[model samples]
Target: MQINREQLFRASCLSLLVTSLSFGIRAGILNKLGVDFQLDKAQLGSITATAFWGFPLAVVFGGFIVDVIGMKRLLVLAFLFHLAGILLTIFAQGFWTLYISTLLVGLANGTVEAACNPLVTSLYTDNKTTKLNHFHLWFPGGIVIGTLIVLLFNKIGLGWQVQVGVMLIPTLIYGYLFSRLDFPVTERVASGVSTGDMYKAILNPLFIFMFICMFGTAITELFTGQWIDVLLKNVTDNALLILTLDTGVMVIGRGFAKPVLKKISPQALLLISAILGAIGIYLLGTLTGNAVFFAAIIFGMGVCFFWPTMLGFVNTNMPETGALGLNLMGGAGMFAVSIYTMFMGSYYDRVVAEAHGNGAFAGQQILHTTLIIPCVLVVAFIGLNIYMKGRAKKSAAAVQV
Candidate 1:
């Protein structure tokens, strides 16, 4: 059957947009849920953590099986889970209900990444890195849209449920788009690579190293991103606006990745990003006044390419691992966020109590503590950059022989 790659790309981007919209709205509403449910920061963190745990579970499993069951079936499951999750969240009465519903949404979000990452790479084989960056632009794009919706709803005094319901619009759009599309065979299957080989590729020491790096990158970007609203609430009354500005910078930065990559190798990019991220996080933790916005801009630029660039590096350098590699990389990242979300929540709660319920001081302290995640990335990525460069020189020398 003939397929239109452009149409498929659009469908995939829309699917991701739905995923990002759901995430943005969920993050925006965390405070509301706490007040309504009489939950503490730790409880709210647990609720937020649930939103990420299901992602790694589904992506790792789905990544292994996506080729066998096909992308179409997986996307269908994602659509249904998204629909059900939204309905459940709207009617949720307490923590358990919200937790289960958020898990379903996370599963849906994971499935979308599992299917679409491979799909996008397959469609744009010649320009995987550049196209992947373009594809992920919608993440921040959707966040911008979601943030605007929340602000609009807030202005009209609409409840959080209504903000969540707004996700349904894109949800239904992507479902229809996906249902009408045809999926291509994954690059691994199309190349006749054995399933055993795919699994073995993941065990390589280099893959393991990259996987560890992915965890740090994920925590640096998503852990801070998920909690941005709450952490910055005391920093500025215009927290959502700040969130919007942060993502807005990401949108622009990602759009320019192709140009940026022409000058810097992916490993070098990761190394530089880790350094910038560490600096930004430290500034965010310790600095105040108007400098918070400056710090956010630095952090945004640092994270703009972290997720997609990491995936692109793996895919480009380790094409033998295929979808499983991408899935595991993505899953590891999400799982890191899940673990840190709970930890940060608990840590914030403890610090707030010690500071006599001074959320501002507690937030600053928490950010200070969180700076360690990015600082570790700085050292790790430096080693990775040096190692990757050595590997590249050897491969180039071998090719010349």
Candidate 2:
């Protein structure tokens, strides 16, 4: 079979585009779904959070079997899942229907990550982190596309279901692209890293440390991005505008990642991301309209490097952990976001009621609560940077001997 890296990479990006399209459109339509079904914020959160929950489930499981079943099959499953989930969501009548549909979409999203992450690493072994960052640019890029589509559809009076159906376009394209391409083996198989070694590597203390940090990174990025509209409703009617602008910032940042990463280690970038994320979230909690855009940029720059950097760190530093390690890192993050999103919803309900329906206060309070995740990440990543630096030095010294 012939390999065309460009075609394969394009297929991966389109797959991710579908994934983010779901997120962007779904985030835009949460209020409508809630209003139509007459559900409370907590119930809305539950329905939406299923996507997060299902993401981890599929990614982790896909990680385990990707070597056996291959990236091609995982992606085929992704296309099917996306098809079922999106169509179901368009026709969903109520909570249970929406929940089941979203779970399917979430599983598809995770499967894309499961297949694409390892596939990218295999294709760009020389610069895994830089290339991964470039590939993940599509996540925010897709969001920007989806957001614009929604804004356009709303202007024309198209319903939420139509916005969701937009996902079908990219889904079919990527599925067909994958069907035509020849997939290389996962990096793990290609490198001859034994299955036993991969298992042992995941249990390493450093791998576990970074794995746990994924929870904080995921929540800081995904949770906050997912809830932007509600969180900033009192601050601005332009919340989606901020989402578009900041995610635009993310798209640009990832597009030019190679130059920045050349000057710093992935772990150092992670440390910087945590710091900026904390500052940005804090400002977001305290600021108002238009001013939120400034904070959004800082927040964008902070989180821009997070998802890919975390996976890149795993890919470059712990190659022995293989697809399992990468998938686990992603899954751990989604799991945290899923649980916290539900908690944030309930917290919003409680605080808003206490304040006699002051939603801005409730939103600010939730931002403050979520702040702890990134704050902890700052300290943890600092430690991670130091530890990784020392390890690199030790390896360099050994090589010189």
lDDT of 1 by residue, 9-96 (tens): 9999999998888777877888989999999999999988887888999899889899999988999999999999999999999999
Worst 10 residues of 1 by lDDT: 237-246
Residue-wise C-alpha lDDT for candidate 2, range 34-74, written one tens digit per residue: 88899899998998899999999999999999999999999
Using lDDT as the measure, the top candidate is 2
Q: What is the lDDT of residue 285 in candidate 2?
A: 93
Query: How big is the positional error of residue 111 in model 2, measured in Å on the Cα after superposition?
Result: 0.9
